[model samples]
Target: MTIPYGYAKGTVISAPSLKPTRRDHETQYHLHFSVQVADEVWDVAVNVGTNDSDDLLKYKLVFDYRHPLIQTLQASPAGKNDLTDVNALPALDFVRSDLLGTTGRWRDSAVMDGSDTPEPVASLTRLIEKALSEKFDVYVFGRFYSEGNGIHDAHMNQGSKGRYIHRPNSDQNDHNAVWQDGAVLIDCRQPEWAAYFAAFEQQYLPTDDLGNPTPSSSPIS
Candidate 1:
């Protein structure tokens, strides 16, 4: 998604190889890489800072998935952007194809849920790790949304915000003992396709036949 501010655009080029990790008795894809945007390579300096490596990788992957070029590359015959001009459902299919490749056919797939499902997570993680290792750079822009938002929200809701109890530098605590640090929240409650939403709000959503903003209970989500 484009941010409110203008940011440099970059390409997310992948390496020719993949890396695998064993977790929960399954193997997955991890891609290793840097990010290139506006002639600058982000998060590539050795020992840059805490969370820098992770942040760079995540940013690259997310933008890569959202890139229009990549979307065009993956568009299917029934799901191309042109089809959207005549059919809204076809447009939705195009969006789905953009996010999930041709191979991702199952509706409500485990990977889409952002859960610890073996196949999806493993596949993604391995792709990411491998990309990182191969040093393929993806062009990315904008700062990643901070982790504090979820934590603050959880605290406000009076939910148990969980503890960071794993002792650092202790042999008793393996890497798995540490808490996973990031959360991916997909906020599609409103029309998140900014351009499309703007057009719909101005023209179609408000009218019966002629142009008007009439009150209706129709859900945009």
Candidate 2:
């Protein structure tokens, strides 16, 4: 039972902004950007970091990511689209698709609330600015909001373990699904594409068909 997943493609119309919030002793950092598809403006919220110092998240921004799915995504309709079939659609799957790279090329990036802009947010701002100036198409893949105003979950969505796994009544692990992963892909300058992928440090690789980590799975180094 996978959660509702989809992608939104549109043109950047507003400057990207970052907000850090603290609620119930937990910190969350979100990068926000606006996009106009047809006549509607949709909000794209990207998670940059968290307060988990021990298991810091792993992030990667490929400036020149090349994949066959880029062409398919570009041909899709603009605005928010809800993908029902995970196997048929062009959803992202870090472990299954190997979008980052076959080899071990992952990095660690953590953002905190501060007066100065962090590298992660700053880099995203630059890309959004460039897209605004060049009129490049911004493609966001994640879970669509129930209110139909925006989309989020712009990160990995599988391989949950320990407390992250779903309990009997909790929906925390509802996002764990194969081919329903989240990512941000940009059609920058013809023939060039930028891709952003993120995941928690404790998420294991070699997930099962259902996107759950197997007994022999291991965390990315």
Candidate 3:
């Protein structure tokens, strides 16, 4: 996979569109933004933010981005730019990538419910939905596709299977670690941010349109 990692901020290019909750097809809420860094308009998508439809994510709107580690990442040589740099800040090493680890951060700070979200989900959804057209800076990691672009793996880079070039594009390997990964951080001028941390699911997930689980030569995990 040719992944790009970088930081960008700009105006919302359009109202975020949602993909309606579903048991399949990976529900999402996506929008386009004019990023200042690349001088390009990019689509940013956030997943349902739950292990499943029945789960409620822990969503928090942080008003600051002064975490020492985050600052360190921004200060790294590869932090600001470099689209395809595997070592860029697009992927992080600190997040837990399990599907449902209680300590996992993926399920945090996002609205997962629909027009009837409840409690924290309700409130969180309102916050995100209302942030449209607002300017915000995001640590982004994504791949290029012919269709609409997405904000995939906007968090820690390790533990998730992805592309690996062992010898300059020769073979395929399970590169589920930091080296071939990308990480990001989202800080809003609200000084508040809707951090888009991510994690990969169980190996049995539907990862391909050809009806094949990724890296699976066995019986689909």
Top of the candidates by TM-score: 2
Write one digit per residue (lDDT tens) for candidate 1, span 80-183: 01220222222222122242342222211122222334333344444444444554322221222232110100000001112312233444311111011111
lDDT of each: 0.23, 0.76, 0.39
Q: Which candidate number would show the highest lDDT if scored against the true structure?
A: 2
Put down candidate 2 lDDT per residue, 105-143, tens digits, no spaces: 677765465432665666777887898889999898888
TM for candidate 2 is 0.87
Better of 2 and 3 by TM-score: 2
Q: 1 or 3, which is superior by TM-score?
A: 3
- Clashing residue pairs in all predictions, respectively, total 25, 0, 9
lDDT winner between 2 and 3, please give it: 2
After superposing all C-alphas onto the true structure, candidate 3 shows an RMSD in angstroms of 7.9
The digit string of per-residue lDDT tens for model 3 on 3-73 reads 44444333344554444444344453332233333455666554435424333333333334344445543
Candidate 3, after superposition: displacement of residue 211 in Å? Answer: 23
Model 2 ranges off by over 4 Å: 21-25, 102-104, 162-173
Rank order by TM-score, top first? 2, 3, 1
